[model samples]
Target: MKMVFRWYGTGNDTVTLKQIKQIPGVEGIVWALHDVPVGDEWPMDKILAYKEEADAYGLHLEVVESVNVHEDIKLGLPSRDVYIDNYKKTIEKLATVGVKTICYNFMPVFDWIRTDLFKELPDGSTALFYEKAKVESMDPEELVRRIANDVDFTMPGWEPERLKKLSPLFEAYKQVSEEGLWRNLQYFLEAIIPVAERNGIQMAIHPDDPPWPIFGLPRIITGQDNIRRLLRLVDSPSNGVTLCSGSLGANPANDIPAMAREFAGRIPFAHIRNVRVFDNGDFIETSHRTSDGTVNIAGFVQALHETGFTGYARPDHGRHIWDEKCRPGYGLYDRALGIMYLWGVWDSMGTSRKGVAE
Candidate 1:
């Protein structure tokens, strides 16, 4: 289980590459060119620049969190072919820089929806929160304003430019049901998985952020059954999953450790984080420990160990800690602490395995 950290870029993120390398057992950064719009071919120079920067700090840029697929690809529009070709090129370019996994998603418009960015926890620590009722009833523009409150870095799924076309985009997806989205995702995989396999890059699809339909947008990658079907859709080693505990754990029905074990080999990347889910369908990000949240993170890590997983893992979205004012969930302080907590569990499990072997 090699650990990686997600670092935005040199100047773009408050967490520097230098700080990332100091995190014990973390060997690389999961990154992408955020400035590049979806469907555009990544510039070779920009890829090289990121590579060189990571090298300067004794870190490897081995995993990219995303090479975003355009809505055309997900919507199955005629223009999808052009965007896919660009995506293919981007995959090839990323492979050149030693990126082992490309973590992308197929969610239509909003990537992840949280009704509150900084909901105050009982501990007085503020974390990203989701009020299901609020999300169900709130207008798109109102939600946008809430997310954009005093933050400079753009939210991953709620890109400002795309959000500007809120009404039109919403109307466009009015006809796109869950079935349509699945078929389109299969179409996308059929087109790109061959290239990914040839290029030695694993295309790891991140599960729908909250692992459910939000704002009438159909979400397909939510549970174990969906993952099983997804692997069969492409049936290639290059086609895989970025199993996220918090994302799938949003629904208590999901048996996270079971999914980890069942889809073990197929999952090439992981986002290990915890969230405290309330009975009212609300949730807030929490520490990596199971007691701190609803997810059994230690059990998830142990399952990965048991399944012989030897892929990349990262501490997923973290709370803003130490009064660090940066990206809402991408702060370094708490995430680094999360990594250590995960490492502690992983290390103990490794020792136990070794003892049994001896």
Candidate 2:
């Protein structure tokens, strides 16, 4: 696996490219023009600026975490065609910078949902937490207010400006059912996959966080069967899945290692992390160690190795350890630690296979 780190950009992220360069196996940055609003064609100058920065540190800018799909596209509005065209243009621009994979999601309104950004764990280190009961009971607006006000930095999906019109966004999605959402997603893929294919960029869709419908919003990209359906939508190598472990692991039914093995050829990018699920349907992000969380991270890495995966992968999220006051899930210390744990598993698997062959 070719490891990468997600850097929000120069001023946006607390972790610097210098610090990311110090990580042993990381060779690239999974990045995007975060300031670029969704549905707008990315400015070539901004894209080049990121390239220049990564180039300065000898880090390849080959993977983008998200080129966020607009709600118009997800809702299948008439204006979606314009946004889809803009998406195509953005793909072309990113391709100019040697970006191999563009990760995007089709989830409506919120991209990912969590009850607490810094929920304290038993060990005193905090991490992103999802409380099912709390989400079900809370008002969407209240949840937005709490999340937006609490964080000093802008949350990717929960952009305060876009979410301010929560009532209308929810009302717009009311016309869309799960099947309708699937059809809309297929429409999007059919429109953009050809552009992505021509640009030599694989479009990977991140699975819905928690892998379930939240606050009555329809979530289609939830598991293996849905993923299979998604792949069939475009039926092209350019159309792929991000295969996020923490997102699908929340469901408990997703066989992540099997997914890695099955979709190995198609997946050009991966987000590998661990989350500990509880009897009460809650989960907290944990270290990348296999034993720390419910996800079979080691087995997942083993499957990647067995498949001879040369695609980009990253330590998705880490705990807020060492009193590091950084982004909720994206921190330096724990993520770097997670990377070492992943390397340990991957390298050991390589040695064991070599020994067996000898």
lDDT string for model 1 (200-278, tens) is 9999999997988887888999999999999999999999999999999999899999998898888899999999899
The residue pairs that clash in candidate 1, if any, are none
Q: Model 2: per-residue lDDT, tens digit, 10-45?
A: 778899999999999899999988888888999999
lDDT score of residue 321 within candidate 1:
72
Score candidate 2 by TM-score against the native: 0.97
TM-score for each prediction?
A: 0.97, 0.97
Model 1, residue 153: C-alpha shift (Å) = 1.2
Clashes of 1: 0
RMSD of 1: 1.9
Q: Quick one: RMSD of model 2? A: 2.1
lDDT agreement of model 1 with the native = 0.88
RMSD of each: 1.9, 2.1
